[model samples]
Target: MFDYYNLEPVLMWIHSTMCGLMPEWLAFTIEGIAVGIFIMVMYAVLAIILIYMERKVCAAFQCRIGPDRVGGRGGLLQVPADVIKILTKEIISLKNSDKFLYALAPFLVIMASILTFSCLPWNKGGEILHMNIGIFFVLAASSIGVLGILLAGWSSNSKYTLIGAVRSGAMIISYELSIGLSVLTMVILCGTMDIQEIVAYQENGWNIFKGHLPALMAFVIYLIAGNAEANRAPFDLAEAEQELTAGYHTEYSGMHFGFFYLAEYLNLFITAGIAVTLFLGGWMPLHIAGLEGFNTIMDYIPGVIWFVGKTFFVVFLLMWIRWTFPRLRIDQVLILEWKYLMPLSLLVLVIMTVMKVFGLVF
Candidate 1:
């Protein structure tokens, strides 16, 4: 039986096997290539699956048939077809556009997501980058996405795109504080910037349960802010279709637009991934305090399964919010962050800090 508790041994064993087959440097090069391909394929598959899932989910929410056109059996192939369509779409040339910046925007967004995913602990031994400042790194990489949006808008030289990009900047700037403060609440409780350590610390109990109401509040705030960061509906003032045509990437077509599309879905995964890692215990299976027998059974399931399941659950929650809630006015969106969420997150952080100092945590 695989040692389900820790798969690092298995990974190391695989590495040793690969090393035995080739020179050390060659093996390392191969592994590096493999990791890059793994990340790319993982996100590509996830983005495609998420796109299909979103269509089906939103269809159900709106009493529509969804993507039932492609394969005649619930349109199972529709998402991929859409991918091909976008991938093949011609890149429209814009008059008087910034050649350098306009071409550079999508790559910025895509690269940010790629960098953020490197530190995300997908499974027991799946994190490619293990920095002590994992939390800070993730936040920093995420912040780069806003610059991409702003540039996309400005480079396009269109009033609509500029407005959309500026709106995105304002929204992200406002929400990032709440997002950071919410994560900080857990950092206080856990006392580590390492995301993997945070998950391991939750082996006994997830932070959402351990820190009492403060953790719960932080989770709520994080969900809202993260959703905003992904530029999803309700909080999707950045890409308000009704107002900005196609928003920041309006001038982009072909794969440039596809890159933005892919980044959006990948951002959703990162948001949900962070929530699962920090609040819901990442890949750790659920266990009651004394249910030794039950815990044993739960551990039999793979950590990757637990992590992906928990992540998609949160993603589902995000999609639910997007389809159900109406988009907020731009001012209302800012108010929700500055006046309400920001203050509330600060309070949550303070309460969590006191709980830790007093040792009153669960």
Candidate 2:
């Protein structure tokens, strides 16, 4: 019987087969190109899905029909149409803008998103680049987008963009601490930074149920900080449409603007992916103690399905928050981070560390 649960062996078989016919170096080169293409294709497909999902979700929340007249039922083709429109639209440039930086800014944001996306452990043996410090690598790559945002605003020479970029910088400086602390808390509990190992650590039970209160606290803190870092509402002060008029990318048009838009959604995916891996067990299926039959049935399902299902659930939670809550004022945003989230995160970190020290974590 073909076991869908483990794909690592299948991948190895394919690579071995290729090496038997082609030069070893050429085989590796082809494999790299293939993986690159897979990442790009997955990136575009997910972005399109998220764009449509958000519109429909927002419409539902507001009690309005969304994309009813676009293409198919429920505006199924609306996002694809928008994609075509962006591809064909002329990229408008400001005459006084720093040409080099302005052109480079959008690419920077998109590239950073792609780099972080590569770090996800998609499924069993499905990781593109599973490194020892995968979670930290993701954090570092995600931070690179901050530079892109700042450059987009500053290079454009627009006051509105500058203000938006400044707010983004302040927000990053504040929320990033909580995010790091929360991740560190998990690292202490899990005793490893490799995402795959973290998943393995949850083989008995997920960290949320295993570590109990502190793990739950870390999860909440990570979600809030992740939302803020991704600049999603209600933490979307960086591009408060009513006030800053599109924020850092105010002067961007067409596909340049599209890059920023897509990056926002993909960044959300990366955030949710990490959260799923660290707290929700990544590709590990649910396994309750003393439930042998139930566990066996769960094991029959593919790891990819588990990973994708858990990830989308988290994504929906983030999306729901975006449509339900109002955007925060800049001061409120800062106060929430510094006064509430940071302190809570620090406390959670300490508690988790104590749990690890005392062997209290299950």
Candidate 3:
């Protein structure tokens, strides 16, 4: 028999041993700090891999080879080289900019990006905090990034930055309504906001499959809303470079700009993680509920692979949309939210609620 719960104490003991010579409280503190650091490091590694994946995907779509000259076949080390160049570049501050906020903004956004990962249930018995309100916590942490963008724009003291900040604010707020409504619909059906519990609910079948028509429609609405929330095209009104220069961080230079850039990619992962947990079922293997052979095959795979595989699929779709579509104007973005997404989500929520009341879905 495979013993899973038995491994927890062993892992804890190893964690405790790694923080040796420290007081018990200090050991816990160190462990927490280590976990946080590990998350950051993982984000960086994933971002690098995603960058290469995105580059290759975009190249194929455009009929070109992306980054083929750096380190070996596909320039595997290209990301590190890019990082080095950014790290070595000059850091410049504008004469009239607010130094404090300008310097603080990038890290604030980066922190928000990392914080959202804390509540994500990556696998069975996995999560940093394991909170019941994990879904709400993730949403709250993600919203903090908009504030950082606002700070960066105002601190830069540039017209373009101000416009970018304003655009991001309006766009995020509009899209968030639909996103929240869709997520709440899931919470209503699952009867708990705990991510692990949500995952459990999807073990037999994904929510997108279980809830049938209503859940599928909500899933589509969620994806559209999430894309806008992540500032991805055709929803990238925030960084409309052709129109607003470099957008909110117009005056930021070197590593500061790099921070903003990295945070965008990190946000993509975080949003996809949320999507997996809510719709596709985080760490849950796929099964048609009547097929033992298929279920057995899925069970053979580790939980982490299922979780990461679904997340990357979502990310890949987002990249395809980014490369294939034209960017929408700010007004059109608002029209998309106020006119289409919000109404559809509201109607879908009502339909889902009615279906559950009638015992139409499990």
Per-structure clash totals for the candidates:
0, 0, 0
Q: In angstroms, how far off is 103's CA in candidate 2?
A: 0.7
> Mind sharing the TM-score for model 3?
0.95
Q: What pairs collide in candidate 2?
A: none
Worst 10 residues of 3 by lDDT: 1-10
Put down candidate 1 lDDT per residue, 274-345, tens digits, no spaces.
Answer: 999999999888888888898888889988899999999999999999999999988999999989999999
**Best candidate, lDDT-wise?**
1
Badly placed stretches (over 4 Å) of model 1 are: none
Cα TM-score per model: 0.96, 0.97, 0.95
Q: Candidate 3: where are CA atoms >4 Å away?
A: 1-10, 15-22
Error of 1 at 179 (Å): 0.5
Kindly report which residue pairs in candidate 3 clash with one another: none
